[model samples]
Target: MIAVRISIVLLLLATLFGSSLYWLIGQFPGFVVISLGTTALQFTLWTGVLAVLALWLLFRILLSLIRALVLPGLHLSRNWQAKKQHKNSQLTYRGLLDLAEGRWASACKLLTKTAAGSELALINYLGAAGAAAELGNEEEVNQLLALAEKADSRNELAVALTRVRLLVGKGDYEEALPMLELLHGRHPTHPYILSLLERSYRNLQQWDQLEKLLADLRANKVLGDEALRQLEISIRAQQLTALAKNLGPDMASNKQALVDLWGRTAKSLRSVPVLIAHHAALLSQLGEPVQAEKELRRAITKGWDKELLTSYGLLGGELAAQQLKTAETWFKAQPDNPDLLLALARLCQRGELWGKARDYLEAALELDSRSEIYAELAEVMGRLGEHDKSLQFYRQGLLAVTGGETQLMVRA
Candidate 1:
């Protein structure tokens, strides 16, 4: 609309100018002369002005023609470059999506193809390296890593972490450890780096290092409450296992190490049933049945754990009698507790009190008909010289074991 208005205004001005020129030329009443190499010409003043205007119009048309001829190639080149860039951007985006979707081969091909053209070459190379790692193409991964390092040498942290992640994913902890340590030195408080380091240490079975790392993570609040609790339990368990390995045939030394570990552990962790059971088992193995019995009783008083109860019943010698007495005390408080009854049955069996074992097993079976209780009753009946009853209990136990699907045993 504006262009149309401007054109109309220009046309009006041209008409006014032409009329004024014609009027001025008539008032002058003069002629102009021009001589060429082989011809001479004379013209009125208006005619000469008209001739000059026509020449200027022709020059403009020729210039327009030249511009029209040259500009298309330049435009085509620019358009091609733009389309190429757009394609490269799309490839990079799709490759990232494919990587997220676990399409390793396709993502590797796309990302590697577009790496050179991608504006963020560092990111492209790193992503391609991850895909290559997923495909187990170690050589391609190294090449891409080198390219990423060259693309931006200052991004050492990102490149190193990428390498560490790939190595860890491939279960190459030995290779990942040094890279993680390097990152740890530079970014001591980075949660992701610390997490990776923790995993690497765990996979390498470097329990001592993991212990220290876990402490740091806890201090920094990198691990949440429940996660920290679980990690602490796992770290302590691994440490105990390591200590057991290094006990060197000395039962007393092994027992003392475990006792010291238990004493040093936080009370919250000590209250965990699994840890308690573990400590008790270690103590029992080291010939400290009394101490094992005490540990189990303390833990059970705090919380009733079936596994702990089972472990409690497994304590032998004079402690068996004492544990049985302790367990029986709980029977009044928990008269129908199947775990308590099972523990009592186990204690009776260990003490060779066949009658009491049979009674406790039957009572437990009445409360909770577990296959284990049936099997225990069968064993007790066999020990009591009741073969027919033993066979009957054994078949019942087998039926329970198979979820009553099929009875494979024959009748005695």
Candidate 2:
């Protein structure tokens, strides 16, 4: 409607201008002339106006023709680009999903293909690297990691973490250590980095480093109470066990060091039965029977531990009788406890109370027919001059050791 209105108004203005131009030309009765090289032209004022209007209309037609020809190509080009972008986005999304679903091969292919054109090349390359790692393609993993590093300098932390995790998962702790340490230096409190570092330290048997890392984890509350407690047990146990492996040139100094380590341990950890038992066993091996007996008694009184009770029966010297008395007292409360009964038998055997050892062993065997109990009873029977019965017990022990599926007949 607006176009029609404008066209009608233009027609009226053209008619009025033409009439005015004709009147002016009639009054002047003159012509304008132009010469160019070998061409000459002459026009009245009215005719020149018509010529200029025709040229303007022709220019509009040419402009419309140009637009008609070029616009579709531009639109097609834009559509093609939009389609390619959409396909790339879909491939990236599916690649991420594939990674989450453990489709390593497909994920690696898709992500690598899209990485060059991806706006988030960091994500694409990192995902591809993980997929390559999962497929055990070490060379491909390295190549993808290099691409990731080159794609974005700001992705150093992410790249380092991915490499560390992959190395750790493959049991390549030796190679993972330097990277982990580097990450640790930059991000001291990052939980996942700390966890990877902890695993690396453990795999390499770097207990001192593990202990320090565990302390940091505890201080930062990165580990929960139960997890921290378990980690404390593991780290302290490893440290003590390592110490026990090499008591050093000065036995006394080494023993004092172990004592100092135990002293510095958290009281909550010290109260753990298994840890106490381990510490006691180490002390006993170091010829510190007094301290060994002290730790065993302290731990068992608070809570009975089967391993600790077993260690108690193995303590020698004047402490044997005292430990036996302690075991008997515990037995009175837990008569049906098979481990405690076995411990009593061992303590009695150490004390040279043959008949009492035989009685405890028989009673324990009645409760639980373990291979170790059968072996202990067989030795006791042999000591008591019952050779025939000793052979039978030994055969029974063999049967138990073999999952009770084998039967053996013995004759003396």
Candidate 3:
């Protein structure tokens, strides 16, 4: 409308000025009638042409201004869309992190709402499965893992591990074994996978496979020197037990195998007190009770472990009484050792050295008044025909118990 109005104003002014000039020309003596009419006609035609052109220019300017206003909105919309997509991507990433950190429900919600089958989505799904497993949402875990597997076959490790853990948790070792075999055969060097597989094999009592895999892991440096040595010792112990079970008490092959295992294990596993005790027990079982006795004594010198102390006396079999004499001598050197003192008290009670047992047990109780020590003392006192003292010690032992002590309490 403005363009039209401006065009009319321009056309009217051009006509008025041109007409006035034509009249002024006529008033001059030399103006011809035809010439003036032609000039006026030409002026009117040029004015209308200029008016259309001016209207077009005005319209173009308005159109350019309108585009300038609308163009920014278009760019802003695009930018907003890009930012929204980015935010969604970030939310997906955060969900994956949450899943890794065990936020199951948050992970599930994020993954379920985000784009599926993309690499990020697949990762999110995997994380959700793990989180779901932690949350005990077994059905959701299975579903998520399955979805993740469907999205990408490269997710085999994640899916398989989830399945293996679930099976292991359920004590379905038979089902878990096949998956472990597959993983071990395929990705034999994956530390995490191999670690889980080794545990599964150990649980199944598949010593031969466990030993072989443990050797591979050790060679690859997947397990540290200490861990590898410990695992090797465990494998040897398991093998020894299997051989001893199959070949019976007097089998020469069984005895020889046990001796060879113990001899090597003693050197490799010297740092691990538990494994050292195991090797000592194997030595004793293989008919080398004195050697086993020396190993336990050596271990005690290196480390103070109460479990090993208990196992040392139990490992000596028929030579237990003689081993106790040696243990007593060792205890004299480390007289204040609470575990040694306790072990001596038990040994003396077993040997029925009543006065010596009472003295040793009383000494142990004085050092550390554990319920077990009190309980043991009470039994020894009762066996020595000291009923009143026994009852009094029993009451004292009961009073010393902390919460959940009933679990540890055993009748002597």
Candidate 4:
């Protein structure tokens, strides 16, 4: 209705303007002349105005036709691009969800599909690599990792670290170390690089390299306090054990190497219960019985470790009598400690006191019936001429070995 009213008003204005123009024409009676190359045309003033209005209306129609032909294609192109991008985004989301949910095969398929068209092609390829690894497809994993690296050269560290993690998870430590070492060289302070290098070195049993890397790990705060503490103990203990393996038959030279190697480490490391136990075992292995006994005795005096006390009993060389006396002294303090009782039994065995050893083994078994305790008691019974009882205890120990831990806890 509004359009109809506007059209009626326009028609009335045109009619009034036409009447004014006619009056003006009667007053002026002028002519308009147009030249086109070799032709000439002539028009009155009203005719010239009408011709100009016709040309303008023809131009508007042409312009409308052009726009009507072009705009929809442009809109369709833009709409297609938007829809394609949205589809890619949804696929990326689903692919990552599958990876998180441990659907290895589905994630591998989705993450790799249409990845070349994805904006996050690197993420797609890397995620596919992880899933492929879980699916035990090593060839596919390598291919995906290579594509991830090619997609983002600037993120080579991320790609390399991902590969290292996969290798380590597969127990491919030998294959992982060279890559980890190279990456570690370039990105010395990167936390993840340090962590991966640490894992690779640990799995490879490269304790010396790990020992050297530890200071950096601590300085960079790569590992938490408890983890670092436990790791340090393991490294130090393994270092001592490795040192014992490399020693020659010469006892004096072995003793010197042991002292020098252990002495170079920090006093705090020396005080670790496991390290001290390892060092004592090394000294015993190298025939430094006096030093071995002293180390165990000193650690025990400073603090009470069931393991250290146990080691003390096992290291009875020429000092078997005194070591047994010391363990018996501690028995008064920790009367119910099974480890201490085990230590006392071992010390008695070293002294060849079969009756006493039998009594201690029986007492230790009553506290905690470990498989080793059963075996030891069985041996003691054999030495004491109780063949039937020895056979029964030995049978129980064998069953514990074949079955669960609690199997030995019940008397056979």
The per-prediction tally of clashing pairs is 0, 0, 0, 0
| Better model by TM-score: candidate 1 vs candidate 3 | 1
* TM-scores for the candidates: 0.72, 0.80, 0.62, 0.79
Clashing pairs in 2: none
lDDT of 1 by residue, 173-285 (tens): 99889989988888888998998998889888897788778767876777898988898888788777677567768776776777788887898887788787877777767
Off by over 4 Å in 3: 1-91, 97-103, 117-121, 131-135, 154-174, 202-208, 230-254, 263-266, 270-273, 282-291, 294-332, 398-412
Candidate 4 Cα errors over 4 Å, as ranges = 1-72, 402-412
Task: List runs of model 1 lying over 4 Å from the truth.
Answer: 1-80, 241-246, 369-375, 386-412
lDDT of 3 at 35: 54
Q: Write the per-residue lDDT of candidate 4 for residues 248-357, one digit (tens) a residue.
A: 87888888888887887777778888888888988888877888888898888777887797678778468899888888888898889888888889889888999898
CA lDDT of 77 in candidate 3?
100
Superposition TM-score, candidate 2 onto the true structure: 0.80
**Model 2 off-target regions past 4 Å?**
1-71, 405-412
What C-alpha lDDT, on a 0 to 100 scale, does residue 195 get in candidate 1? 88
Per-residue accuracy of model 3 over 1-412 as CA lDDT, tens digit each: 9999999999999999999977865665342222564474334444555677999999999999999999999999999988877877888887787776777788778866664634476677776776677778889878888887887787678778777877787677888888878887888777777777777888888988886686678766777887777677778767756664666556577777766655655564556676666667667766777788777877776666886787674674566577678787888688897778888877776677878877877777667778878888788879988887788778777877853332222225
RMSD of each: 8.9, 5.6, 11.6, 5.9
Candidate 3, position 120, lDDT: 70
